[model samples]
Target: MRITGIRATPVAVPYRSPEVWAFGRRRGQVSVLIEVDTDDGVTGLGEAAAYPSADIVLAVLRGLEPLVLGEDPFAVERLVRRIELVGTWHHVKATSPAIAAVEMACWDILGKVCGQPLVNLFGGRFRERVECFYYVARAEPDDVAAEARLATKAGFGTCYLKVGSDDPRTDIERVAALRDGAGPDARLRIDANEAWSPGTAVRLIRELERFDLELMEQPVSGRNLDEMAYVRGRVGVPILANEASWTRYDQLAVIKAGAADVLSVDNQMDGGLANLKRAAGLCEAAGLPVVKHSLGELGVALAAAVHVIASTPNFRYANQAYGALLADDVTSGFGGGLESYADGCMEVPSGPGLGVALDPDRVARYAELYRTEGASFSFGDPQALARAHALPKL
Candidate 1:
């Protein structure tokens, strides 16, 4: 069926607690909800985390609308190409997220059309359940220890602590306390959010090695591959590249430079499902495991990630900052509950498509709360919209 219309609504959801990571403190999540309608009366839903505002998301939707309207929704690849062609010269930042929303919607439509689950459409399930890790966020040694204990008690298999808060000694003490609290069973990972320098990363990893940490994520910045390689060589633990590896080229560069042992894939930043699959294939071929990085995604994106991880043959590590972290999520039809976690693993949704349904009422509530006042379309002014519509399709 042909795509008939595309719509976006900006929404904000307040965090249950202030989420303080290496980036900074976040009081709330700003996101945009995307819906694609098709000629066959089928609709698909997607959500994007836009941070400060949803203007970028609105621009993406408006820019893509002309290209997307009247095109077959099943032609996912062609649609992506169209977006690329339009965004090539300007280096449009919204290309990935916009295409992601469309891709997710296509998957949803495909699942409905084929009467199959999205995971099955990809290949098939490699695992029955996906393992997940919890982020402790910024906390003191005692507080972090308590949180780690709670996670362990809650049956979480892994706990990730935020480092690079201040002193390396203090960070070491926090790691030590976490290890002590989590005991030997739970996996412990640290994320510096690219806070350390090459020298500092080396020193910190050397000091933290005594705690038996699992991995250090983005210990140094992603820009300098040589520095990452140096840090990798000096550190005993595996270094995961989060912000560093966004696409196939980035992944290849990291692998060639020996910059990292593990690759963290964030669907939002790394294009959509198809791009993620492409990256995973490359990583699998290179014999590296793919872990989902947190972008404060709600159930919709999380479900997509679960299906991707379940489909990938070589994904070994679990992701952090998911499950019941969001205060409210519209997409929960595919079994949205933290109770699914058992022995540190979460079961992938067995339903069709992304196996989730959007709650219209909840969507409306979020729309009312976080909706920004401005022009609905962001292509240009009204003049640009008319001009774009008048242009013939290539």
Candidate 2:
């Protein structure tokens, strides 16, 4: 069937709490959702990372629609290549999410046409359900501990702790409380979001060792693999790299440097679901445990992550942040609504494609939010916005 039209909807969903980063709290979560329409009346759903600039992504996606108007949605590679995903001509940083959203929607159309779930299409189910973690945003030390208790009671195998406070002492105090509150068996992982230098990361990690962290993520900057490798060698905790690495290119650089023990891959950052599977294959070859990373994503992206994780063989941890963060989502009608995380694991949506359906009403609500208040970047740390603009010529 020929392609018809493509639309990108901007969504603004409030975080349950101020999503703290660097040293402060963010106002809310803003994302751009993608919809690809075809001539046979088949449609697919997808999402883009909307921080820094959602408007630009929307504009870019709109401009690219004509390139895909008459193509086969099932020709996934050709369609992805039709858009600039890499090299000097690509704008993957600002538009990766937009392109990824479109790519995922194509997969949705492909799956629906073939009558199979995304997990089935991606080489069957490696695991019917994937383990997940509850994310504890930057908050008071006591509040962080309390949230860990609730996550543990809910049966989450691990809980995420975000570290990057201006005061190093606060990080220590918070770690203590979470450890004592969650008990011994519960795994604790911390993400610094590229906030420290190698020396500081070494010092902070050494100090937090008594609590036995699951892994210290992105402790140092993403720019230098050698710095990350230095911290990894000095510390005993397993290190999982995030912001510092994206594609197989970065993954290999980090691996060759012996920078981290684990790799965290996000579908949005890696381009799309197919690229993520390739990154997983890279990890498989390296014998490293790779997990999914969900930073400020909405339901459509989270559901896409679930499908990829379910199909990936090297995914071996309680991966991602979702469910508890967003107050509401723009999709519905999966085996359960996308908010169905329970007992430390989320079952893959058993229906066709991404296994989630978009609710027109909900989409409109978020779409309106974007129209009114979606113009600027407010991801807690302002430097991140600057870093985004500094993306290399490509």
Best-fitting candidate, scored by lDDT: 2
Candidate 2 error regions (>4 Å): 85-91, 333-339, 375-377, 381-394
User: lDDT by residue for model 2 over 320-386, one digit each (tens)?
Assistant: 7666666677777431222467687877888888888888898898778877876432565665444
Q: Could you list the CA RMSD of all candidates, in the order they appear? A: 8.6, 3.9
Clash-forming residue pairs, model 2: 222-244
Which segments of candidate 1 are over 4 A away from where they belong?
A: 86-94, 333-337, 372-394
Task: Give candidate 1's error at residue 189 in angstroms.
Answer: 0.8
Candidate 1 has which clashing residue pairs, if any?
none
Q: What's the number of clashes in each of the models?
A: 0, 1
Worst 10 residues of 2 by lDDT: 385-394
lDDT of 1 by residue, 84-156 (tens): 7754512343456666877788887888788787888888898888888876755678888887887888788
Model 1 lDDT on a 0 to 1 scale:
0.74
Model 1, residue 273: distance off in Å is 0.2
